[model samples]
Target: MLTLPGYLVHIRKRGGYRKRFGTRFGRGMDIPVKRAGARRIWIQAVSLGEMLAIEPLLKALASDERIEIYLTVTTSTGYALALEKYSELAVGISYFPIDFYPFSSRVWDRIEPDIAICAETELWPEHTHQAVKRGIPFLLVNGRLSDRSFKRAMKLRGFFRTVLLNTAQVYACSELDRDRYVALGAPSERVVTTGNIKVDVAIEPVLDPVTCSSMRAEMGISDGFLLLGSSTWPGEEEMLIDAFRAVREHDDRARLMIVPRHAERRHEIEAMLRERASDLAFHFKSRGLPERELDILIADTHGELRALTQLADLAFIGKSLPPHTEGQTPVECGVLGKAMVFGSGMSNFRSIREGLLQYGAAREVSDEAEAIATILDLSQDPAKRGKMGEGGKAWHASCKGAVERTVKGVLSWLDR
Candidate 1:
């Protein structure tokens, strides 16, 4: 189906056809084949977030002299990140195949993995079936099943049950996730809750005072409250701008920085900002820090979200505000000890949201009105903000060691 003229034409128009088709068509052989008698393991992570979550595990595995690691990603962004961050550690990195019988079979024959591991929710039927037929152990690490995905999988229970039964093991993110997998027909004994590896994301060292001061000066801000709208989706940006406008009514020094989920959407967001709030001065991060103080900053660059999080006094996570959007992860902001607020649509990270709320680390707002009110309230109460920040840091610290546990689990399987 992917080779159909219509599909080929569509993909070509979208661009990056070479990177997307290189693996499936057997075009890119940048990484040489493994040597004979080498112990090889193939690990697949679907995108940037999954790749990040598996970083520590990859590092741990890199120390073993006997094992050769091959990494694959489904998206161009993931493939780039895997290479950029893990090229030295990985023996081979490439785009995962399209999961068609021929494509998967060809890719598998080349990798010839002793064991195959799928990160997160990547359950490719053809790929898993081929591995099972070859007597290879197929495992799912950091497994999760959201309510929306559970309903969809239930519709194909018979098909998924057969696939799940053939799998060797599933290390889920939470007990709830494990239960959902069992309900969907995975053998209960094969699934275990191993907690979230995101909790173990490496924290960069604190920026020196000189660097922080220079960054602030470059941004044209001396003393101001920075509100960051991190990884926002469509519709949520407008709501954040509206809330920021309301926030400025009380304190003109309040500035808003927005980082859209997709950097390519900056033009659309810029147009909206112009049409809706032309009065506010806004600049893009790609353009060196504003010469003068600005009301809004658009972070259109990649790989700076973590660094930017350090500049924010308070953060509002995106995707949650729009009723239809399920929301992005706030774990990064939470780990930095930033006081955060999100909307009602957080089913994708329900466990994380609940944990933050339970620890007084974050707040949930229902709409623009509540979002505005909460941002204003948090801005006014320095003590409250401080408490929230400390609470978040404590919570983040408590969730550590999942990476170690997950690595140990994977090693045990290899030994068996």
Candidate 2:
């Protein structure tokens, strides 16, 4: 029952994949258990942030000789990092097959997974529906439903409701989120709250110099700057720079470093500060741009952020700015235990944002004016900075079991 459009997209993806033999299609690509005999478990975490949550699950699953994990992602940056970070965990990392009826059917028919773990909310009707038809248990792990996501689901209420009946269980990230899922047609009895698996992504703050050095040196940043902001977005930078300048107005010794969210915006970001902050510097890791000398250092690159965030004393995760591309709140900052600040546009990250605020792990600013005020206060107050970092770290440690709990629930569901 393949639609023409689905068929065409499948053929296109297959052909595109075929064109790049070992480059992308090489055996090193992900190998999930889609076959009857395949002991593989397919775990789909879309990118670096998701990969952070997935890493711990992968590790916990590693102790099981019977379990083979097929980790899948779309972005090249994700593919490389998964290979670099979790090389030894399970099977392989590769492109997910296009989700057409026949293609997904073919993928499912081959891998024949006994049970599947759909992390976060990547619920493709075609994929889950096929799993349903085949009697494979589909487990939703670390799930959450924003009010915004909930409203959208109500539109597709019946469709998602069908998706729910096929799912054995879902370990939602929050109680309110669980309620949202049930309201959107997830089976109320099957959905359980297990908090966020993001907490498990926090490692013991390795503070390893070799990995940190390799990454930082490559990004043209040294120990001098405070590495205040990790991944900044557009309008936020002007606000942040203003805040940093305000910080300078109080403490001139403070050096700041930032990484923009998009690589393409590097030139514009450089240009944005040229007239006023002419001493600003730009380094591109992709094009072999050498680490150079300048005041405002921009790590305009990719694949190094996980390690690069280590150098931050106080990290401002971008994408929390107004009209953002919908920011991610830099959950990785919590892993680094750095003093964090974000804008009030954190409606999307409500639970985590409030959690951080309660733990005194972070401060949320409402706008550019407030941003300046907060930064200036923290700049002159080293004690506040240290306190925030300590509080964030403690809270981070207390929430480390998310991955373990999630992985176990998935296996239990599939086993059922």
Candidate 3:
């Protein structure tokens, strides 16, 4: 197959990424390097979550004197997080060269990796083809195939078949996902069911009532109020506005906490929330809030929401409430020791969320009325809420080690 001018394609890909996700994940920058040793392992993760999934592997490989891991990401956000979180293990963070022929060739020559591992379903044709052309064994680790994405991929069988075959080994997230890969032309022998690596998050229970109370107080949430948290994605705020209002009619004074997926969207979401709840004041806005009349408090920042789960009397995680994204966040309100409410549209994070629900840690509902009622029910019963939180923490702890398994896969490729 023919390709476009390498420089022009590179320029366009860079510009487009800058325009759409540049602010969120910066233009992938090629870091200036001075290393006498060559990278034996080139690990490419597109962004933050993908980058995160590979941390265990990097840690595991750091011990090998023969191996050098070169980490690369497509977004600035991923780069920043990698530098911040995995600086000790990641040898170098560079922009993944945009997939144009000669540019990719230049990248491969510069790094001169013996092996390359890409996380998830990111199968860039140019990159893999070059790796194959140069005889560098390539592997896809932690591959997932949601029914929706797999069906669409099957449509492009002609396009993806060669690329699939290029992968030396496939570490799928599940057996069902493995079958999906097999259908997509991945050799069954190369496919192995490696459980999803997201389960490796260090989710220890943090019991800081004083700090939790202060955060809630700063956000204008009074005692005995429900905290509905909307994590990442668009369109979730609108869903929760109606959801919260419905809860208020029954509870009189309900508190809502919204944390958008992107921190930059906070101002936009705050503007919308202010118009809807004109009387409410929030800490983010710095407006004087009545201790009692405050209904909704927008969490316009990051890093604290996961910890703030402890303050929710009864919680509703936002992304799941709306169809903006495929699945809901499964906010782990239960992780904070509370049976929080979710929506019927828990298409995202289905398996993990289902596990929480099966353990009686989370409960899902159809609409605002049902969600509100569930929160209120949990609020009225302390025993039930405490039990749910305990269950969630238990389940979260039980599911650790995704990172270890992923690390093993990355190391195994060194032999090939």
Candidate 4:
């Protein structure tokens, strides 16, 4: 009953809706029959970010011969990425069943996993309760609560307490996260600080310099200082475009790249580009490469941020500016050794932000004007940028090993 409205609204939308419609009702899931004598572990990642963050953990578990993996995602893009990236590693990849009534139970019965894991803050009551009822240990990996989420959870304190009670363990991203879980009624003994797996994802660059140079050439960006807007949300794009214009006035070689959080928002961003920065030559990744040289590139695609961030001289972590709280992950930028800037709303990654600032890897701005000024200043300072990049690499190195800790803990629990 609670999910009916969301279900109806989801189905009414376009793009992979019909294909995912059945999964919500615990039907049409592509989970394979469990292998005999194998320990099947069911892992649920809510979307693309969660899916990417959990990749290392997935690989670690897959290394064990006795373990079989069943991975489920709650978004179309996440399912698509799973098929593209983890089809071989994961025994089966499908949409997570709706976390309500028979839907959750039906899926649970079908998989009959020895252990159930939810990534980050995706602790659905019905899902956790289903695992508890079946005596299956439920785990929350890389768990965190943003400032906004903590406040909301306190409002529904009773409800969250019941959910936490069912969870066997929570692998938090930081000490603060551990405290937040404990305050919300999660048993302190069950909550452990495991750092963040996102650090693992950004430990090294996947693309080589030659490949990065070729990619830039393909985008018609030749030797220009690239300013990337990583995982931008609404309003961030406009601010970036304005900053880019200002940046270009100072440095003619400055290039802009905007990768919005949702690829579906491509058209919206395109329209905005036409309105705000009509004078600049821009190209969209969704469309083929431009015939002429381009000054701006819009990456309106999925699973390409890592590749794009590698090409950036300076990057902006989006969703941190005004009107949007709970910022996007800056771990990738920091780990990739890029000088970065973000707005004040980094409560989602509060610990990481503090670390990055402390290490001189990133700069935090108060608003759009300050962000623009900071970007402008950083654009011309090669030595400062280099130092910042080194700082980012240092900070990222210090934050590594969460995946290893999480894998060891999970396997030990399963053995017990």
Question: Which regions of candidate 2 deviate over 4 angstroms?
Answer: 1-38, 208-227, 287-291
Per-residue accuracy of model 1 over 141-253 as CA lDDT, tens digit each: 88887778888999999988988987889998889999989988999999988888877777676666677667766876545888889898888888888888888888888
Task: Estimate TM-scores for all models.
Answer: 0.94, 0.85, 0.81, 0.97
Per-candidate Cα lDDT values, in order, are 0.83, 0.69, 0.68, 0.90
Candidate topping lDDT = 4
CA RMSD for every model? 2.2, 4.2, 4.7, 1.4
Model 1 error, position 363 (Å)? 0.4
How many clashing pairs in candidate 3? 8
* Model 1 ranges off by over 4 Å: 2-15, 35-37, 220-222, 287-291
Find the candidate with the highest TM-score and give its number: 4
Higher-lDDT candidate of 3 and 4: 4
Error of 1 at 107 (Å): 0.7
Off by over 4 Å in 4: 10-15, 202-205
Worst 10 residues of 2 by lDDT: 19-28
lDDT of 4: 0.90
- Better structure of 1 and 2 per lDDT: 1
For candidate 4, report its TM-score. 0.97
Candidate 3 lDDT by residue in tens digits, 381-414: 7788778878887877776676677767767666
TM-score for candidate 3, residues paired by index: 0.81
- Alpha-carbon lDDT of model 2: 0.69
lDDT of 4 by residue, 1-416 (tens): 67678766874563566666788788978778888899999999988898888989998999999999999988888888999999999888888887788999999988889999999999898999998899999999999999999999988888999999999999999999999999999889999998888887643457888999999998888677899999999999999988888888988988999999987888888899899888899888889887877889999888989878999999999999998888999988898899999999999999999999999999999999999999999998999999999999999888788989999989987798
